[model samples]
Target: MKYFLAFLIFSQTLLASDDWGQNGHRTVGETAENYLKSRVSKKIDRILNGQSIADASTYADEIKSDRAYDEYKPWHYANIPFDQTYAEAEKNPKGDIVFGIEECISKLKSNKLNKEQEQFYLKMLIHLVGDMHQPLHFGLKEDKGANDFKVKWFYNPTNLHSVWDTKMIESYNMSYTELSASLPELSKSEVQSIKSGTLLDWVEESRALTQEVYNSAEADENLSYRYMYDWFNVAQLQMKKAGIRLAVILNDIYS
Candidate 1:
């Protein structure tokens, strides 16, 4: 019975963020929908099977997989500042966050990378883009995100990072197309500029936000319901931004 109980707990943790509908998660679907409507480059269309970039919204199913959840943890921690205090992650790429994106992008482009390697790296890329937008993924020493925080989300036991990454986003109950339509307007030039930076820059932006988006509640206490509500809005904004930003980058790469 004890063994079964432990197994149940682990399974719940694994399944908790499957839909990303929880508070503080992103709005990736909404941004991707908006992306499909915009005129995308011909090269990106070919890579996306002759469909425009917007048509690729269906591909989001590929992004949200159990494999991605499992793969994210080790790589996420690889970027945490080990030798220095939490402050170090704020200033440099030495943390796994920046290096992970650069390394994956490098491998994605390398002639030496095999099919399996490419697939692994690509999935990591997709997931990491979402992860970077999760402010807690840019976490400090207190929790590594998973350990220190505690919560009862929609009546289930959970943690902060998991909530933002999968639960909150998945809760929108819209297809990527429907969700994408709801994003705020962006100018072409603004979209192009956001897409121009290296993937490392995106990770750095998340890291920088970690410091500015301060939370004062202690780790052991449940995060205030109000705080989660506000954070969810911020997360949706970030996710939409990320999806559009991702489409822009994808358009340029294949263009």
Candidate 2:
């Protein structure tokens, strides 16, 4: 069900804060395609019309240009304080990626939405699932999901959030197809391990990684080759795992 976008998630447009970026998100979609069930893949094709998941991957971000979609901005992330569990954390009144993913699953499972909504939420699940795995997307609210935690990427001033979301992936010198192709195939057990978790568990895992990212550098430090060396693999693994986990969910939802 890879590409079928008929009447919805239209021929329109991109990312803001906490976005997982093009290569990262597309890599997740591309990789997930490898694991998708034949039946479910067909359904995805019908729902999305001609749009591949990789293309639908960025629709949530692309729609940011429209004021009508403003409410979805908060759905990109969940930034709780360092010490609090998500349950203990002060919830965003506007909701977060966790809320976004769960709601998408519910609506899709309910099978009550019109054709337009089915396509929209399917696209949403694709994006939010990818975004949720980005450590910065789970970053602290105090730092605007690390947007305020400035760092120089190869002496170019930016922030830690950008570094993980896009910069590091860009430095790897691979297209989404190349990256997805090069990923070592996991054993079924390994895939299951990554998939083995509730949405809340996944969120907590991402939030914990956010801590490591915060600890990676001092604010405004000039990070270059060494930073990429240390963390690029982590980013790759997260994207791969996200793709695998996404396939698992889609199969369950459509099975």
Candidate 3:
């Protein structure tokens, strides 16, 4: 078990922002599933061939191993330096999270895609929305979203990107359903406000939060219980936001 865990960590280290690890992505999917309208939920169920959104949420990451999906490598995150807004930052010609997300939304909204394409875009959209909520996913270009921001997570050497992507949520030790059930409740207006923004508006929000995260987490520092305590609430809130915002997008598309 020990050796297997070590190998798992090493494999993950090779991938960047692999998008919130499996649990975090499923939390987003589960939360959105809870909020989905009955009709919209049914539509999604049909499209996914009875797979719950939570089950489908990790498809984008799972495809990473296939060379056919190599073109999607850049779609997991975007880099906009602290000094620049996403609009002012030069876009990746291949695509970034923002571009990927907008493209998915556009494709899903068109209603012209065949069933397979619709399933692919819907699954990707579910995952990317979760990625957009992780502040580090909107990180500085130079560091590749802090994949290079080396740090010690509980004395195990790791980078800032991996810390946020998995360490905190995994240490919390809840399944996605458990975590989703545990999220703080918000009033309807709060949900409305969270869902009110355009995709770019949300990207900017994540960018600002990313700056604060970098300021708080220092390179080479040992992050343990205290670090997790300080940041877990933030992670939970981001999860909630991602889930609600995903429901918002799906509702808009299916309504």
Candidate 4:
């Protein structure tokens, strides 16, 4: 029974390492929903069949178990090395997060897609925007976005990716709604600044934070209160950025 419990916990951690985990993704989704232009919001509602962005946020991750979605595995992240800009970084043939996002936006903007195709790409756009904001999602290919950078989270063995993806957010024990509500309020100008960057620009921003994350959390280090205390604010800011940027994308595509 004890072993089973341990296995369950380990399994949960592994699941959380994918994408931004449910809470982080949904927090971004919910926050974006609040900022959406009314016409864009209505169009998104029609596409998602009245489903809230928060609820639709995890659809990409949920499809991972099916073999059909194997091609999308790489869509969750872009592995650009620390020294290279995204433009200079070699593109992933299988499609990285950056490619996935651009493709989604391009397809979404085109009038060629049928309603079903439009809905599919729109969902992908929503999820990929959230993924793009996760620092490690723009990390080194060699390390698989720090998945191999094993560390201890309050004494339990885990990897750096999981720490940033879920552990820090989970440690706070808040629902997505609660987390969204607690995000630092930004002025219109501040939000515009965050939303102003291009897709590659945002990728570069996350890559910068990825470097900071790697420097802060060394392999085998035991990270707990201090680590979370220091980085949670950064995570919150990223979430807010993601939300605002998602709204920016949706508004642009629908406008």
TM-score of each: 0.62, 0.92, 0.93, 0.93
* Candidate 2 residue lDDT tens string, 148-244: 9999999999999889887887788898899888776778888888989888888888888989989999998999998888888888889998998
Q: Rank the candidates by lDDT, best first.
A: 3, 4, 2, 1
Q: What's the ranking of the predictions by TM-score, best on top?
A: 3, 4, 2, 1
For candidate 3, write residues 13-56 as lDDT tens digits: 44524768888988999999878899999999999999999989
lDDT tens digits, residue span 1-255, model 4: 999888766665455459679999999999999989999999899988999999888878766755798898888888877788989988889988888888898898888999888878888888999998889888787888899899999999999988888999999999999999999988988988897867888888888888999999777999999999999989999999999999988998896
TM-score of 2: 0.92
Q: What is the lDDT of residue 131 in candidate 3?
A: 95
Q: Please report the candidate that would top lDDT against the real structure.
A: 3
Model 4 spans with C-alpha error above 4 angstroms: 1-16
Model 4 quality (TM-score) = 0.93
Worst 10 contiguous positions by lDDT, candidate 2? 7-16
lDDT of each: 0.53, 0.85, 0.89, 0.87
Candidate 4 deviation (Cα RMSD): 3.4
